[model samples]
Target: MTTTKPNMHAVAINPATWPRQTYFYYFTKIAPSGFSLTVNMDITATLAWTKAHHVKFNAVYLYLVSRLLTTHPEMRIGYLNDQLVTFDVLHPSYTILHANRTMANLWTTYDTDFETFYQHYLADQAEFSALPGPMPKTPQTPNLVNIGCLPGVHFSSYTPLPFKPLDSFFPIFQAGQFKKDADKTIMPLSITVNHATIDGDHLSRFFNELQSCWEQPTQYLA
Candidate 1:
C-alpha cells in the first residue's frame, strides 16, 4: 500500500486565551501525571449491526473512537515543535497480532466518511496484517493515537504508561475481549490521557458520547 504522508500540522493554541490554561500549567508544571479510566461499554447494538452488515468489529471500534477523538478538542491536544497544539484529526495507530505470536503496528488515515476509512483499514490489514515486526506498516503521522486490543482478557481495570515523553499528551486506547452481561454484550475500554489536557469532566463527556454511539450504531456504523 503506497500513500503520501498526510499533511499533518498542529495548530498552536494561545495559552492566555485557552480555557484549560491553568489546568494545563498545574498538571504539566506543578504536578506532572496522567490518568486512566476504564469503562465497560455496552456493545450489543454495535455487534448486531456489524454482524448484519458483515463488517469487522475491530474496524468499527476503531472508527467510532477515532471519530470521537477528533470531535473533542481536549483529546486532540499535543505538543508540536515545542508548542502546545491541537491536531485537525487523529489517526488510529493500532496493533495486529500475527500467527507467529508477534505483533505488527498498522495504521490507517481517518476519514469523515466511514466507508472510505473502513476500506483503508481493510486494505492495510490485507497488506500487512500477517507481517510480524515491531515496525509500523505505513509511515506514521504525528497526529496519531495508540490503540490496541487484548482479545484474550476482559479485565476490569487497566492503566498504560507512556513510553515516550512526547506521547504524554496523546491518548492511548485499549479494548478487551467481549463478554456477556445478562442480555447485553460488554467490552472493556481503557483510556489513558494526560491530565494536563484532559479532565474528568472531559472524559465523562467522551464516555457519554461513546455510549450514545454504541446505543445507536446506525448513526455512524451504518
Candidate 2:
C-alpha cells in the first residue's frame, strides 16, 4: 500500500503538563481496566479493503490502530512506577497463536507506512514463534498498546477484563470473525480502555476516525 509521513511526532512528549492528572485519582481507585469501556463496531469496510488489496487483515489493523493511537495521546497515557507517564512513541504489541493452540506475544514499533509495518509484523511473528513457551509480558517498551485478533469467533461485545486487572491502563483491541449481516459483511471490533484515563469523547473520536478511514481505504491505507 502507498503511504505518506505521519502528521504527529515520531517520539517526543511535553513533560511540563500531564493531561490526565485530574483523572489519576479516579482511575487509580476504579482500576484502569476495571472500570474500562468496550465498544463493538461494524468494520465491514475494513475487511473488504484488506481482501481487495490482498493485505493481511491484522497487519493492516495494527497499522490503522497505531495511527489512531498516536494521534490521540490521552489513550496512551498510563500510570507506571507510581508516576503518570506518557510515551513519546507508543508501539503495538499483539498476541499470536501457535500450532499447539497456545499464544505468544509479539511486538512491533510504530511505522507510518503500512507496507513497512506489515513487513516488520511478519518478521516479529516468525522471530517470536521460533522460540519459547509463554513469551514475556513486556515488549520493546512500557509505552505499548495491546492488540490481538480472534478470527475463530464472532461476538457482539467482549471484554479482556477477567484476565487483566482493572487498573491496567493499556488499551486492548481485538477483531472477531466476520459474518454476513444481510447485504453487508460485518466484522466485530472491540476496543477496551480505562474509564478514568479516557472518556467516551476520546473513544467516539476514534470510532469516527476509524469509520472515515475504513470508508475510504485508498485515501488512508493505500
Candidate 3:
C-alpha cells in the first residue's frame, strides 16, 4: 500500500540577480531503526567548472543524479509508518557550500530515475524564471511540508576539518555501482546520510562509487 503526493516548491533566488541558482534542503527519519541521519557532499568542481564552461553545471549535476535515480530504482526515498524511508535516495543533512560560504548548495533528491528527474529539474527551472515574485517553498520528507526562506540571501564561509589522522579520508556510501577519476587523486565530497540504513562500510562504498563516476564511467559521463 504505497501512496503518492504532489509537492510544488519555489526556487531560491540570487540576492544580486533575483533568480539564478536555487537549492532545497530536507530532513528525514531513517528507516529500520529510524535513527536520524545527517550527511554532506562536496561538489568540489561543481561551481568552478560550470562557470568556466558557460554550462549550467547545476543542471548537468542534477541531470546526472536524476539519471542515476532512474537507473537504480531502489535508491529513492519514500514514506512509511510516519517515517521517511529510502531504497535509493540518500537524503543529506547539512548543505555543502564552497569554502564555507553562507550560500546553500544547489542539490536535490528525487524518487524516480535520471531522465524523469532531469526533466523535472528543467520544468522547475522554467517555472522559476517565469515567476514574477521570488520563488518560495522547500521540500520536507516524511511530513511532505513546505518551508520558508529569507530574502536577499548571500552565502557564508565554512572551514574543513583541521589536519588530523582521522580527517585524512572521508567515506562514501551509495546503492548502486560507480567509479573514481584517475587523474584526480583527492576527490573531496560532503555526504549526508541516514544512520538507520548504513554503517561505516556503506559510507566507504559510496565514496568509492563517487570516485568511480569520475574515473571509469558506467553511465554518468560528461
Candidate 4:
C-alpha cells in the first residue's frame, strides 16, 4: 500500500462568470437537494470480456464509472477547504470485503490509462484486502467518488443516505449483482448526486455513454 501521493489540487471557479453559479446558490443556500437514480445497465459484453481476460468485473465497473465521471465536470465539483472547487481528477474509494466478514476501504488514484489504474487497484487490494476494519487503507481525499458493489443482491432500486451533511456534492455509486434478463445481462447501478452540480441531463448523458462503453468493452476496456 505504499505509494506517493499525487499532486492533487482543487481549482476554484469564478462564480461571477461560471454558468452554474445561480443554480449552485439556489440549490445549496436556498433549498439544498439531491437525488438518486437506479438503472439496469446492460453488461453482457462487459461480462464476457472480463471472463475472457480473467479480470475482475468489479474493477472494470469502477474504472468505467470513474472514467465517465471525470468526463463530466459537474460530477467532480466539490468543496475544498471551505471553498467551492473542482478537482483535476476524481479517485475511486471503494469497499473490499475481508475474509473475516468485515470490510476495508481502499482507494486508488485514477488514471486515464485503464491498465495503469487496474494495476493500482490490484496493488491496493493485495495490501489491504485482508484488513478487517472500515478504516481506509490509504489517506482519504476530497476528490473521491464513493463506490461499492453488492454482488449477492440484485435489487430493483437503491438509495444511499449519507450520514454526513448534505453539503457534500460528489457522487456516490453502488452496483448490484448481475441478473440475467433473457439474452442480456443487467446490473442495477444506483447513482446519488447533488442537484447543485448535476442535473437530469448530466445523468442521462452519463448513462448513455456508460451503456455505450458496456456495449463495446473492447474499445474502452482493452
Candidate 5:
C-alpha cells in the first residue's frame, strides 16, 4: 500500500541480450530472510472471444493478474536470492512472427498484462496487413524493442511434461473464442528459482491456487 520509489536498482535487460533458453537469473528479493519455496501457476481458460477479439483474452488475462497485484501488493515481482522473482502476476506467452531473412520464426513474448500489449499486437497486425505480397506465416515480433515497459519478458514455446493430465494444466495458446475446431489451450507458466526460496510442495499448491483462479477468472477480476 506504500509507494516510495525503491533506491534498490534492478536492471531490466533486453530480450535480444538474453539467451533464447530459460536461465536462472537474479530478479529481486522476497523476504529479509530468503524464502524457502517458490511456485509458478500455469492457468488455462476457455475464452469466448474471436480471433479479432483474441486480444480480449490478453486483456482479460492481464486484468486478472493486475488485480491480483493490486490486492496483494506485497506480491510485486523482482529479484530474490539471485532468482527471477515474480509476484502474484500470471505471465502469458504470446505468439508472434519473427523474421530471419526468408525464413520467419514463430516465437512468444511474455506479457504481464493483456490490454496494453494486445492493443499493440492488433495495431501491428493492421499496419502489416497493408503491406504487399506473400507475407510470412505471420508478423515477426516487430522491430520495436524496449525493456519491461510494454513487451514485458519474452519466452519460447514450452512443451510441458509428456504426461497428458499434468500437461493439460499448462496455459499455452493464442487468444481466440473457444470453438469445436479451436484447439484446447493451456497456459504453461515457468519460473527459475533459487533453492534457497522455495520447494516442490509449494509449487503444487501454487498450481492448485492458479487452477482455482482460471476456473473462475471473473472472481479474481475485482
Candidate 6:
C-alpha cells in the first residue's frame, strides 16, 4: 500500500447545478436499483501482450486500466453521505482468484509504475491465496474503483447485477477469458458505471481510449 496519503480533495456537487438533478432524486431514492450498462470489448492486444511477455493478463490489464481512470476524472465520481464527490485518485479493490478456486477481495493502492503496482498486487495476492475463508468485503472507499476478472467463460453480452441498489457513481469493470475468433484473438470486457456520472458520450471516449492503449502495448509500456 502507498504510505503517502492520497491528496484527495474533492468538490461537492451542487444539486442545483447538477445536470441529473431531475432524475437524481429518483435514481437515488425512488428507484430500486440504479441504472447500469455492460458491454463486451475486444481485447486482441491484451492477449497478444500477455503471450509475448509471459505476464498474467489480469495484472497487465489492470495497469492499463489504472492509467485510464487516472486520466478520466468523471469515472471517479461517487455518492457518499448523501452527496456526490469526485476523487482525485482512484485505487483498485478487486478479487484475487486463488489456485483452489476460492477468491478474496483485496485492495492495492495504485501506482503509476506498472511494475511497482504489480509487485504490491502480487504480494497481496500471495497472502490472500494462502488463507481460505469467506470472501472478504471490499472496502467502501470513495476512491476505490470496483474491478474483477472472470477467466472461466466468454459471453457476447453479460451484465453483473449488484446485490443491492448501487447509488454510488464509481465504476465496475470486468474482463472475461481470451479466446480465438477466426484469425483474430479477442477478450471480453464489461463496464458498469452509474448513469448519473457517466453517459453515452463518456463511454464513447472511454472505450476508444482504452482500446487504443490496448492495441499499442509498447507505447504505454514506455
Predicted candidate 5 versus true structure: per-residue lDDT over 1-222, tens digit per residue = 111121222244344564411322322123211222222233444253323344445445544443333333223334434444333332322333335323222212334444444554455444543344444224332211111111233333222233332101122222222223234444434422232333355445544665577666545432
The candidate that achieves the highest TM-score relative to the unseen native structure: 4
**Residue-level error in angstroms, candidate 5, position 17:** 34
Task: List per-prediction Cα lDDT, in the order shown.
Answer: 0.85, 0.68, 0.33, 0.86, 0.35, 0.71
Tens digits of per-residue lDDT for model 1, 172-204: 889999999899999999998889998889889
Worst 10 residues of 6 by lDDT: 1-10
What TM-score would each prediction reach against the true structure? 0.94, 0.80, 0.40, 0.95, 0.34, 0.82
Q: Which portions of model 5 miss their true places by more than 4 Å?
A: 1-45, 49-95, 99-189, 220-222
The TM-score obtained by model 2 is 0.80
Ranking by lDDT: 4, 1, 6, 2, 5, 3
Ranking by TM-score: 4, 1, 6, 2, 3, 5
C-alpha RMSD by candidate, in order: 1.6, 4.8, 14.9, 1.4, 13.0, 3.0
- When 5 and 6 are scored with TM-score, the better candidate is 6
lDDT of 6 by residue, 3-98 (tens): 334345567778889776766566556753434445555677766777787777777777888789878877877755666876776877778766
In angstroms, the error of model 6 at 109 is 1.4
Residue-pair clashes per prediction, in order, are 0, 7, 38, 0, 25, 0
| Model 2: per-residue Cα lDDT over 1-222, one tens digit each | 222222222333344565555566666655542333444555677778888888887887788888777778777766455455555556777787778888888777678777777877776665566565777433535666777788899887777646545444667788788778776766677887777667788888887888777667677677
Worst window of 10 by summed lDDT in candidate 5? 141-150
Candidate 4 wrong stretches, greater than 4 Å: none
